[model samples]
Target: MKNIIIFGLFFLMVSCKSNPVTKLDNKTEVGLKGNWELTSVSYPNSSYIKINSFGIADSQCFETSSWRFISNNNQGEMALRKAGCPTFSSDITWYVNQEGNLVLKFVGADVKAKTVKEGYVLKVANLTENAFQLFDTVDVAGKTITLVYQFNRIK
Candidate 1:
């Protein structure tokens, strides 16, 4: 009888164990839902500049730009606001790829070619309720540049 009781207790504990992968996926999904504002842009090779350090015009436009991620449908939108330029908004689909990379697909038809470009895959450095950081590398003029974007959740 004691052995049977011990086995029963062990079975209950085992049945209650949650899968780690499922837990992480849920946490990441929840953490990403919100309005995120670009706070800073970092370039390791070049001089790092804060969003506020940009020129008055650029600062105003950049400060007003933000990214909004919707939790219900996994869709996102990027809003760019500039004083002289017309307000630009793009439809984007976001998802965590199989390799855990954050992928942003821009939805639009190219004017000349009538082709849709591929999405941008960014490595997620950190993601939390209050902050998110993404890292990516770009090659420009034969020089490799590491781009880091820091965002803060809007209250």
Candidate 2:
């Protein structure tokens, strides 16, 4: 009887283990569902810039430090308002690759990349809890390029 009870408790403990990735319900959309702030950005050759998001309205307007991330499986959009640019608004489609990485597609938003900045789209690969990297084929001159943008969770 004692052995059986111990085994049962162990089984229960093991069954309750939760992985951050699994907590995300594909049906409900996961990590992107809350408020996030940009922590650090890495440029070519390991250059670094530290930044904090400031805005008014939860991700609706950038004030001095804040950005809101609201997304779904079919589509997701970021509303950025910075001290310099208060009237910021953009929408993008969110998709999941077979590898379970979340990607933001510009063309997926039904707009031409050339019409925007980089030729029409972007992709994010290797996303993990509290941090992710950004890949964009768009640059200031409209050339194909990729860079990793790292982010941390706030609140």
Provide the lowest-lDDT 10-residue window in model 1: 50-59
- Cα miss at 98, model 2 (Å)? 1.9
Per residue, candidate 1 scores C-alpha lDDT tens digits across 32-136 of 898988776666544433232211233335445688888667777777665674466676677765566777775543332225466677877688779988776
| Poorly placed runs, candidate 1 (over 4 Å) | 1-26, 45-64, 82-86, 108-115
* Cα-based TM-score, every candidate: 0.63, 0.43
| Candidate with the greatest lDDT versus the true structure | 1
Expressed as tens digits, the lDDT of each residue in 83-125 for candidate 2 is 5545545555554454445544433256753464432223454
RMSD of each: 10.9, 14.3
